[model samples]
Target: MEHRFDLLGSGWVSVECDPKSYRLSSGNQKRALAIRQLIDSAYNPIDWQLDFKSGYRWRADRLSGTLRYGHEPAVDVKVPWELARLHHLSWLAQSGDEKSIREFRNQVLDFAAANPPGYGVNWLCTMDVAIRAANIIIAYDLFISQGIEFDEAFLGEFHALIVAHGKHIMANLEWHDVHRANHYLADIVGLLFVAAYLPCTDESNAWLIFSVEQMINEVERQFTPDGANFEASTSYHRLSAEMVVYGTALVLGLPKDKKAILGGKNSFPDWYFERLERMAEFCVHVTKPNGRVAQIGDNDSGRFFKICPSFDEAGGTFKEQHLDHRSTVAAINGLFEREDFEEFSGPDVALDTTVVSALAGGQKITSYLKPGDNPGAMGVQITGGVDSGLSVLAQTFIEPVDATVLNGLTVFSYPDFGLFIWRSSRFFMSVRCGPVGQNGNGGHAHNDQLAIELNIDGEDWIADPGTYLYTPAPNDRNAYRSVHAHAAPKIGDKEPSRLDFGLFRLENNVDARCLCFSPDGFEGRHAGYGVPLHRHIEIQDGKIRITDLISGTKSSKVIPRIVKDGTSLRKLWSLDLRFSPGYGIRD
Candidate 1:
């Protein structure tokens, strides 16, 4: 309550506005209530260095490495980072909640004091460092936009925090020699925010120029012409798309003098916006009739920002948390004003979409909601928002597609991402057959080549099992990512890909290919077992038929090995499936 307002953030120009003046359409009441709930919970308080999942409190004075995983609890560092993100504070400030606003400032000062630069578990991961910085900027910007003022002492401290995060990101970027995935992208995007807000010093401007150049190069390198993220996962597509959208928005809003630093272009070129729209198009297509994505690869339920609140933190609701992909869709739809995405996501999304539109300098958005409106006929009860994009977002690689319609539902294929989706009024099908992602490293991709996620009627009956957890829970992680967890063709004692290192990365030994693809059906194969294993899925009215064949092998001699203990032969393999709504929470 006593901290200086300027002590809140580094350099904020969009000040001198009124929170009372901030307004949203009455139709967005439900979403606004969600925002209130999220902020109210913030008062439940945050322990900046506590791993809520593991109940391990990180020592503030120790080096990040000094806190070993083998320590009691083998803590999940993300637990603290989640709350420390401070995104809820923006919603609080956005709503003109003065009490929560003061608490937001107080919490930041306390967090910085506890977790100084270069020490504590929060500072260990540069990606989290950058993400924290971005969230911090958003909250600070909103506060200042309301003409909130601060003392010089508080401003100095806040500026130091921004500089610290930027220095850490620059020093420890998540760059990979072969592929700069979402982690690297998070680094630059976070740095981009720091550069824009930090009073334009030489160091800050250097960060601006460097982040801009990296973003331009990576947009083309990371995403294919089809707009699918190279990460090979639907949830990840939402994740990466969020970062690209919000980060680009900030870049676009930069002054002409600042924008000119990008060589000659004032901002990202025409192609950048085109690809971004297509990225949203991918979201538009992959969504099932149930309002969730196909869950093509991994989905750990990661997000960039949370504008709404429906996610159960303990990961209680699997369908609610893991399967839902609406908020990200809503944000992108509103930001770009895509009627197509709005058609898929529905009009009620104005709740958070309006805020995103506000961030984009108030893009004109109209309501598409009627008295009775739902994404699907019986929409899944879900409410949430994503972090900039997940998220360490997902990827896969496949040869360019030769898509054709054969008197059936239209086929939407992401050739580079290796995803083939077929959608009609009541039936939706997505076939997962493609090369490995992360340059064949398959970092965020699952071993579900030739797999399929099916939705018939309004509800999701069969789907890919989501990522249960990572690193901390290796067995669960491996179990969820295994070929058995997906609806792919089964083989006797064969796995399409190896769970290399038994962690995030996978080996690309299996060659996934799309033999023939059309709206009528799909025929594809993988070279994982001894003989070429082929799977053909035929799209029929109100139904789908799947057929598996083994080439150059006798049915008798090459029969699958006898199975017991919850698993059967290829024909009957549902016995060993696992479903998880998100990381560390299973259903």
Candidate 2:
């Protein structure tokens, strides 16, 4: 099933023009210098392909498909793709950093020349391909807006890169079954940006029509009724949300007629903005008072663009920063200027808000903003388009939730997301119970069916261990996602889900359910280990009381025990769970 785009071979780079531009601010000059300096940190120019941890280099001569994921000594394809994502280089060009700009240009030409179209591990996964191309487009568009110049030779080479990336995505789109995931969504977005930025041509226009329709349709599909991502992982929720928000803004910024396609007959419905707001609302609720989110599921620290700094003292590499979820809140706030979204908006996310403001048709954006002030206003209006089948199973309102769960604890339940949250001024807890993510493929869902992450008195107590790695080390991957990693009942060495399914999947044996959910407490059960295990959690007199109602007596050597909540404060200090919060982060 091959589709066609007019951009196939040489001379596809159309003449540059002042098509409506959403120019990103030239970020912090100091940080831009660091980014430019470290632009070459991830890849080895000698071979142009690399594995950071293992030092294994995939030669440019090899086809991406030839190098299998999780090969023996273990090579991560993400390392090279990290360099190719080109965010730092883009910023360098945007900042007018002459020295770094030269490096950026040279690197772009070298990488493109070394790894021709479909060669090397960098092009292996279409998801990465889409992300890489989108970033390159963003950089190029920004450079154009800033009046930065590039040599004719590099422009020719770069346009060829764009043509190749566009063709590769259409051919290898990750659309397979009834359930399409983030990867598919990203593919559409990449193509959308490419089509939007390219000079007016039938090929780019056709791509525009196809991608715009699909972006709206897929965003509706991938997000749950409660606004949680279908991937079942909170961090991944941020990644896919970014693709939708950023892509939507670019479409809104297009010239009137081109943008009319979104508001006319087909129209970009209101529900799209509503769900996006709720997705940001979900971010507010899941994040703890400590400012870090409860790593509810897989967090690869994935992003479409590094528009904002990771803000972590331990941050430098692409994978290091993920705990901060407020920037997403700020991005949403910037796009719609929704009053509810202002909760997480401040100095922390001023840059993020400014970036989104530019993309959403705001005026010339600056890198700074006064507190409580948004960048600029987008006069564009979104009218038309039907419901598009958007179901709001759980409603999220900006006002403080009035419902109480005994003793001032606020209860929030997103059944679609399979999470029950109870929070008070001094105590907060989240219980995981629901369908395996990715439509039960459980690609990003862990085996912690009855798992709970608790923070009492603003100190991390029990936690859901985060995803450390994928593909490269199978055992660690299984271990991190194992039921044993969380404070949930497990029967003597019996697993609730099979880890052997695949690196990215989990087959849930446990039909975990919440039988009783009320202000009193949360009572849930699961049949993951061949026996029904019940967990009753209630707060009493400010301390937590967790009871396991396992039928144990006469013939009962087999009984589910309540996993303890207290771990060493030392370990808790290590990472809120004695594990890295994201992939490639140190243990």
Per-candidate RMSD vs. true structure? 12.7, 12.3
TM-score each candidate: 0.79, 0.79
Q: For candidate 2, lDDT tens digit of each residue in 1-587?
A: 01111110111122121211211123323322332343344432323365545656665456667767666646666655655666555556557666655666656655564556666677888888899888888777666767778877567667877888888888889896776799999999999887776666777778888898898888888887567888888888988988887887787678776665445443477567667766777787787766778887787778887666554444432333577787788877777676556666567666677667777678322222356743221111112222122211111111111223226766777777778887666656788988887877888888878777877666666667788777776777787888777767666576888988788888866787787665456767777766567776655543455555444323323332222334542242232434666666645
Relative to the true structure, candidate 1 has a C-alpha RMSD (angstroms) of: 12.7
Cα lDDT computed for each candidate against the true fold: 0.65, 0.66
583, model 1: CA deviation in Å?
1.9
Per-residue lDDT for 1-587 in model 1, tens only?
22211101111111122212323234433433333333333332234665555556666556776666533434565555655666556666667566866677656665565566777778887777888898888878777877887666567767878898999999999898896688898889999989988876778889999998898788888888767889888877877887877777777566656666665465565577667767777777787776667877777556666665344446442123555666667777656665656666565455557656666666443323344552221221112231121111111111111222112466776657888877766657788888678787788888888887766555454677788666566676777788788777666556777785647688777787777777657767777764567776665442345666666644442332332211223225563555665655565
* Model 2 TM: 0.79
- Per-candidate clashes come to 26, 0
Query: Which candidate ranks first by lDDT, i.e. highest?
Result: 2
